[model samples]
Target: MTEEEPRLSAREMIERLDSSLSPGRRVRAVAALLAGLAGAVFVAALWWTEPGPLPGRTHLAFALFTVFCLAWSGYGGWLLTRRVPLFATDRVIAAWIGLAASLTTTTVLAVVAAQRDTGLGGTLLVGGLFAGMALVLAVRARTRRAALLRRVRELTGQEDR
Candidate 1:
């Protein structure tokens, strides 16, 4: 008689499926968390410590910037707390969120530069760089997710849709 292989428990199966955390990823996450938190605090401090009264629009801009940084920090915190891996899905979401924030901040900064008769070209150039980087990250995340999905399908002997 042929012997059947032992079945794995749910926890064992999950452990096998989930990828281990890499040092690079851990550093990136922690860096993001620290940078975001620091940026938020710095912006808030600037807004509070301004000597003269600022315009209402300026206040709104500062608030928006602070919130953006907070959002990034919150995302980092969430990533750190995730014990169950969502594969590259979390990365895809993070990239999209980063893209949105980059676009918004870039536009705001460009507008401010133009209003202040500063270097609009330089601002746009830097902003474009950041936006491009975010786009690249999003694309990479999506590609990774797709590849993982394909691997899973192949392993399961399922037909690709």
Candidate 2:
């Protein structure tokens, strides 16, 4: 086995490769775009699924949950396919995403707990798990972003920049 050469940055690494992005790359990108659309459609399709009638509030809660999920998914897909660089680095953006997911999950779970006949312990347990994971992710993201910025400063010799 051989170790790959280290490049300064991802862009540099891509430039150094100088290979065609044929076959899977474009297909994969388009697929990614379509996947988001498909996800929204799939979520929307749930409305059509039926075994029997649902209580109005129960159905409304589920609908709100679905909308929130779709919006988050759509935002994620946009981030993935966006050509222009965002103001924040990927890790920072990821931290924001972690926050969004955590808030959404906690809220949705709480709504479900209130609307449905689910056990309190189970709902709290799952909601806690989601919150805990989000906390860990946010902490890790901050650490990584700081490290990355430090490295960039060291490499460029521009500490104040």
Candidate 3:
């Protein structure tokens, strides 16, 4: 009834995105899937290899990484459901990249800690990596989003009409 009301439901949102995807978007999705699969494989390998006893700090780092991934994934899913224009294909690709980076960092730190028997160093490494990755991703996303908004404004003129 309102001019600003959303016309799509959650399922419809996903369907619309899938239907309107460009070739580039499709490629990005495929790349994200591959990256996620690789991450999963790496995690599984870590478990299977049983590198050895881990330090308490490494365990803490793993837990933090798990929590971060869960939170960010949920946020991404919410954005997808809402069908926010700002959450474009590029943003999704970035999210996947961030996820992969976090996973890989956590896994590597855990393995290194186990192998070297140095929990504290592994924990610090994982924490520092997570913080750095998050900051970088946030800045990149914000920059891209700002550029997108500027482009939209240029195309549509002012919204004061």
TM-scores, one per candidate:
0.78, 0.57, 0.43
Clashing pairs in 1: none
lDDT of 3 by residue, 17-111 (tens): 44344567545555545544454455445645667887786665555555444444444444334434443445745655575656666666766
Candidate models: Cα lDDT each: 0.85, 0.61, 0.57
Instruction: Give the runs in model 2 whose Cα sits over 4 Å from its true position.
Output: 1-35, 48-88, 115-117
lDDT per residue as tens, model 1, 15-128? 576564578877777887898899999999999999898988689789988988898788778777777666688799789988988888889889899999999999999999
Worst 10 residues of 2 by lDDT: 13-22
Highest lDDT, which number? 1
Model 3 segments more than 4 A misplaced = 1-19, 60-89, 92-141, 153-161
Q: Model 3, poorest ten-residue lDDT window?
A: 78-87
* Better candidate by lDDT, 1 or 2: 1
- Cα shift from native, residue 127, model 1 (Å): 1.3
TM-score leader: 1
User: Model 1 off-target regions past 4 Å?
Assistant: 1-15, 18-20, 157-161
Instruction: Predict model 1's lDDT versus the native.
Output: 0.85
Sorted by TM-score (best first), the order is: 1, 2, 3
